[model samples]
Target: MNPKWLTRAGLCALLAIISLAASAAPAGPPRVAVTDLAYEERVSEYFRVVSASSKSSLRASGRESERDSDDAYSRRSSGSLNARSESNYSSTEGTYSYIDRGEMRKFTADIKGGLIKSGRFELVQGKPFTDTKHTEKLYDIIARIKQGMYPGADYVLFGSINSIEFRQEANPIDHTNTVSHTLSLELVGEFSLINTRNYAIKSSFSAMGTGQDVKLLTSQGGRVVLNRGKVVSEVSRSLGEDVARQVEEQLTGVSSAEERDNSYRPRGESVREEVIIFK
Candidate 1:
């Protein structure tokens, strides 16, 4: 064989081997960073404890100056206090937190686990968000992604609590004086998956989780405490899984996918929680 011909054949053989190896090797799955489940709560009911000057202050301030007589017999001392009639009270401020930031991770616990279990994508840790200005930043998926909240991730899964409610009721038993103290918790959330490189929304959906706790009280006046931890855990688990499943279905093409929809925007947001305080 000619030396030039052998050299060409050697190069061809090397190229073929490289091609074969590339074809046999499996491609890595897309990497995804599941963001913190952001949420905004509106004040459904709230109690404001305003401490103004005592009501007595108004009476004293409104009292007219009396003309004094030049005799001690005309003078009498009234049992009035030295309290100022002017309204002077500071606006009461209280620290409010529904759940710990660390515990908030529970909201997306099952989503992370489900993604791992499915073996469909590589999971990465999304960055922790700080409270800047307002809670709007918490659920701003686009802003978060642009801020590198999902570093080294090909996709980002953004979740936020849309609404959550707790309801309580008391009902009497059919044939007894016993009453049932029932507490029900329900939460709804929305999610969006976006391509980190292009910021294209790959998919979006909403999911809900609900739980209830009931106790039988012997008398109508009996008290009951609802199982908060158990209910929250149940809600988180169920909500996370539902979000994860929809994500999987949309990403893996198991169902009709919402692809390349450029006009998609994240959902609207609401404000603070409502709780009462008495002192």
Candidate 2:
């Protein structure tokens, strides 16, 4: 119970508190809120062709005969002969057609669902907004953030469908008796991140995947079936994964979860500044 011993114990307790505070301080990984994750109707193309054939037959027959005679001395000569001809034939004709409605809906839904399942951030739903000249929606988003719809969110995520185009064309070669149908889905994604605190953009990125075409034949008296949902799902999943990876890299300077968790403050970086600059 000496006074000097008590002073030493107090000093030890203070040192422990300081160490705990230092350890508990946030190292990296900013708490982010992802807003506006709705499906934007982009270009989706789907086409299917079905073909059928019909056949007919024909037959024809014919016969002919001739006779002649021959004699000696000053007479003439003669002969006899018989002949027959017959023909049988068959013919076939085929028709080709297609339908492309349900595929579009399936594709759009697939993309929306895939992005939501990527586990990047807290996905929030907002009113629909088209990419056309519409500043009202943007302002509404800002107002919502200010009204505490999202608390402690550091950033807002917004994106647009720059283009969604599907090109479909089928060519039938008369000499080859073959029909080639090509279907392509091209999508472009334009994304921007805005700082919720200052309502300023943090980063902007764009990615596009095009020239994906599926070719099939429609000659063998059958229908070529394609699942539009599957194709869109794949493309959407790819786009979402790429976007998530890029965003993580820009925000945390790392591409993977492990790197994000183990990241430390750079030698001189005390505060991470928002890199998005408005023009």
lDDT of each: 0.73, 0.57
For residue 136, give model 1's deviation from the true position in Å.
4.5
- Quote model 1's TM-score: 0.63
The candidate that wins on TM-score is: 1
Best by lDDT: 1
Residue-level lDDT of model 2, residues 47-108, one tens digit each, is 55555455555554555555555653343445555554545555544554432211122223
What lDDT tens digits, residue by residue, belong to model 1 across residues 95-179? 4444322115557777787677656678998887876545555656678788877888999887777778998898988999888
RMSD of each: 17.6, 22.0
Distance from true position, residue 178, model 1, in Å?
2.3
TM-score for each candidate, following the candidate numbering: 0.63, 0.48
Error in Å for residue 278 of model 2: 60
Which residue pairs does candidate 2 place in steric collision? 43-164, 68-78, 68-79, 69-77, 69-78, 70-77, 70-78
